[model samples]
Target: MRDSIRLRTRARLAYTACRRTRCSRGSLRELSAVAVLITALSSACENPLAPELCGAVADQVVPAGGAVSVRVCFNDENGDGVSLASRTSDGTVATVTVRGRVVTVTGVRGGTATVTVTARDPGGLSATVSFGVIVPGIVRLTDRHGLMPAWSPDGTRIAFLGRVPETGDTGDGSIFVMNADGSGVKRLTKSISAVAPPAWSPDGTRIVFTTRDFEIYVVNADGSGEANLTNNADWDVYPAWSPDGTRIAFVSDRDDDIEIYVMNADGSGTTNLSNSHGRDDWPAWSPDGSRITFTSRRGDDIDIYVMNADGSGVTNLTNNPALDLWPAWSPDGGRIAFRSGIPFSADIQVINADGSGATNVTNNPEYVYGSVPRWSPDGTRIAFTSADRNNTEIHVVNADGSGEATLTSTAGTVFGDHAWSPDGRTIAFSSNHSSSGFHVYVVDVSFFGKAAKRATR
Candidate 1:
């Protein structure tokens, strides 16, 4: 059975690569680095010398009690290496050095190393190739506080809500910003309640977010000129920017019931979309600005709904008995992710754009309180906040519901709720990241790169 499966996979990949490059049977030998995926297939066929146990062309010998790097090559024409770094069993990847076809692994206590590689074409066809390495423990991203994280478009900076604990009489929340590596912490906003959910504009220059009272606001990237975009007495929260940065959409309760609304870049020309007598909150715009997905209680249960930019053709994309809210549009605009179930026991769920194939990505039943599922710009993964009061952390998973891992490790601090950068590389969220108070913080997920190569770096 394994042999047949391997043969089928190789044949499929060979056929795909052949078709993509218009290569004839004889051209297979002439082409280098065909981007064909090879897993646990045997080497009994042609190229019998190819390494099977390691999933590469050659293997490295690590000295006992010492560490060494191993490199793998997929194509000869592509000078770039496969770059399958070290990964923990939980799916966090460690940083690796790539030199041509060789990847160096450090700190080897002598154990099997397993990693995955991914490649893509212009037509969106991709493949994942897995290989194993022997090494010791690999470092990963750990949570500091349960703060909301947002990555910068370029993956350089993360804007998040930082938490400042009450100091004697201080009871205000602040906004915090930092690099993806959790260094260079700086406070962005100061207030009495909370300044949460700092979302970067497409250019990464301005941020649109909400204050504790649910007033929409924007600020410069350097934490200056914080201005309230919506000075309304009612709630105006969850601000999302249009793909083109010309408009912003958010959920407002100005009409008594929560409704979706859009406004100009400078916070003018506000227009309501849902116009429903029921409640609707959490408006997430598609990458193209053609549609918006949000959470609404219009039906018997809280479900996900997608509507045209003009507020026409509203459709409930998720109709499950379990409550669904906090719908986040994928970067490709093909999927919507949201939190389902009651507050204390919610789970992260995703559905197709047309409201089909809704899957529970995080099947954890250990009181998984989820919120704000954001997709990577590459559309390969989603990040969300998961918590159970005592512990809160940012978690990421493959779009197809695999390779789940945690990003934060801070205990006692509550964390979750976020927005991805336009490039799908960073996440912005609100949390009490530190004892200072509750503030906004950002995290860069660019390090993860892609699922096949996603390991802590």
Candidate 2:
């Protein structure tokens, strides 16, 4: 009986090999009769030279600069020794290394790559499994108090308010410029009391900022031409430059009550856009220079309002009972993102440009407050600051209220006033994670993949 089974097993193996090699259909039909009779016999005496691989062969997503390990089980049917090797499809996207049965992959950049692991036996039988590797994570840029960073129009440099450590006076802050990677940090304005974040001109040559004395100032990118755009005495602040570089919209109480005003690029042609009885501040210009958005208190609640560039057709974009402030226009001008809920306990909310489709993005129960929801230039993600029970950290969420990620993880530190680089590759923000005072920081936004939760100090 054993001899008969052995013969049947050999015949079945030969038939399978013939079919795999696309033999004639007549031979296949002839083998079909024997295939059923020898199937169990072949299974009992399978070839040992053939190699088999076990474990997941699905693609993996990894953050840039992060590593992931995949363990595969390899075995030979004949009980012979098996070896494994690993390789990457693109070395620039990721690197792969083999150690026994484990394959380690390291991401080198922010793109898709494939990894192939092969198991081979001494009998010349080999099996290969291919999977994808993706790398995404955050890169810390600065270590100092770099508050309210604004990217240049060219997306190469960043301008922010740097707190001069202990200038021996009440006002120690100055307007500073640095490369987008947090290098070449240069103080652009010396001996001036800069109180607000600087806004870059459309041409990238000038920066407009506000002072503690309620005045608007503009300085050259190299700190050469420092001029006060608004020398008024009625607290002019929150200057926003139009997309065309033709006008700047700011808030001032020069009209007895705080209201939205627009001035030319050189601080001329000042006109009140929202001359409401309520206080309106925090003016932000639309990307097309056709509209301006600001926060107002026209009713019992603080809401977001929008108006034409020429200070007409004022419309309330967010008229909820909850205070909606810090209105930021998306790059496409289709939606507006802002902060809602009570003070110090707010969430990031987005609304349509026409005052519709309001959604709460960061619905964290422990959230104390969130601030400055800046949209990426691509208009896909929104970066902001949120504080929980522990500390205030930088966070980012998708435009449709998904993929909430915490970017910073310094206990007890406050990170706020974030600005996205024009390419949407990095986020520049203000944080005191390194010391007692807030400093500027730039973190790669693309690295918010699976490895983003790893604390970046």
| Highest TM-score model number | 2
lDDT tens readout by residue for model 2, 218-326: 9999999898888877889888888888888888999899998888988888898898899998888888888888899976889998888888899987778998889
C-alpha-based local distance difference test score of model 2: 0.78
TM-score of 1: 0.61
lDDT tens readout by residue for model 1, 1-457:
5765666676667767787888876676533333233322233232222112234322222322233555554431222223333333322333335455455544333334455544333223334445443332212122433355667777777776655544453434566667666678776766534566678898889878778887888888898878888898998988889888889988888988889999998989999999998898878788788998887886578888889999999998877788787777776778888888876677887888999888888887775756667677678898776766576766778888886655554444545556666665445555554575444544445545333322321
> For model 1, what is the error of residue 356's alpha carbon versus the real structure, in angstroms, after optimal superposition?
1.8
Top lDDT model:
2
Kindly report which residue stretches of model 2 are placed more than 4 angstroms away from their true locations once superposed: 1-144, 165-171, 447-457
TM-score of 2: 0.68
lDDT of 1 at 254: 90
Off by over 4 Å in 1: 1-146, 163-171, 179-194, 342-346, 388-390, 406-414, 418-457
